[model samples]
Target chain A: MRARVLVELKPGMLDPEGATVKRALKNLGFSEVEDVHVGKVVELELDSEDEEAARERVKEMCGRLLANPVIHSYEIEIG
Target chain B: MRARVLVELKPGMLDPEGATVKRALKNLGFSEVEDVHVGKVVELELDSEDEEAARERVKEMCGRLLANPVIHSYEIEIG
Candidate 1:
């Protein structure tokens, strides 16, 4: 199975790297950009064949290592 | 309008960060995970209303700042 995990900062958190990009864009003349948020995508290939089991495992992975629960949230997809 | 840019390292290029994560996962006992690839998502809120125009602009942004043409490939999405 193939799995993907999308990890993002919680809604109200500030993103310094993303803000730096926004500032750089404005300086580069992309004046229409108002805000920016950055996130991570982790793509994984699993030896397991069951999609459900892979998803559950990926979720556990997120909780354990892929994300910091105080500031990050993640979504898991399996195929 | 809202725009999203997904930036990933082109296939065959090495990803040390991702490889490190994979090793960490193995150490943590996720034995079923075969491979891992890490990518980035940049989400932007733009003042423009036209989705097509925003997408085009975001593509330009990707070329200029969000991605490295040599080893990085990007996808732009607008809403």
Candidate 2:
């Protein structure tokens, strides 16, 4: 099975990197860009064939190591 | 309009960060994980309401700064 975990900063959290990029874009004349936030995608290949089991395992992975619960949240997509 | 840019390393190119994370996961006992790849998601909010123009602009952003064409490829999603 293949799974993807999308992780992003929790709402209300500051994203300095995103802000920097947004400023850069404006300076580069992409003034239409209003806001930007950077996140992460973790693509995983699992030995398990069951989608349910894969989703469960990936969720655990996200909670345990893939994300920082206090500031980050993640969504899992399985295939 | 909102746009998402997913940037990933090209196949056959090494990902040291992903390797390190994989090793960490193995050490943490996620042995069922067979492979892992790390990528980036850049979420952008643009003032433009036209989806076609948003996609074109985001593609240009990807080519210019969001991704490195030599080592990475990107997908743009617009809403």
Best model per TM-score:
2
RMSD (Cα, Å) for all candidates, in order, is 1.3, 0.9
Tell the DockQ for candidate 1: 0.85
Error of 1 at B72 (Å): 0.3
B2-39, model 2: which lDDT tens digit per residue?
Answer: 99999999999999878977888888999998899999
**Docking quality band of candidate 1, CAPRI definitions:** high
Interface C-alpha root-mean-square deviation, candidates in order: 1.1, 0.8
List model 1 lDDT by residue over B1-79, tens digit each.
Answer: 8887889999999999899989999999999989999999898999998888888899889889999999998878778
Worst 10 residues of 2 chain B by lDDT: B16-25
Off by over 4 Å in 1: none
Q: What tens-digit string does per-residue lDDT give for candidate 2 at A1-79? A: 8898989999899999899989988888899999999999999988997899889888889988999999998889899
- Relative to the true interface, what fraction of contacts does candidate 1 keep? 0.96
- Output the number of the lDDT-best candidate: 2
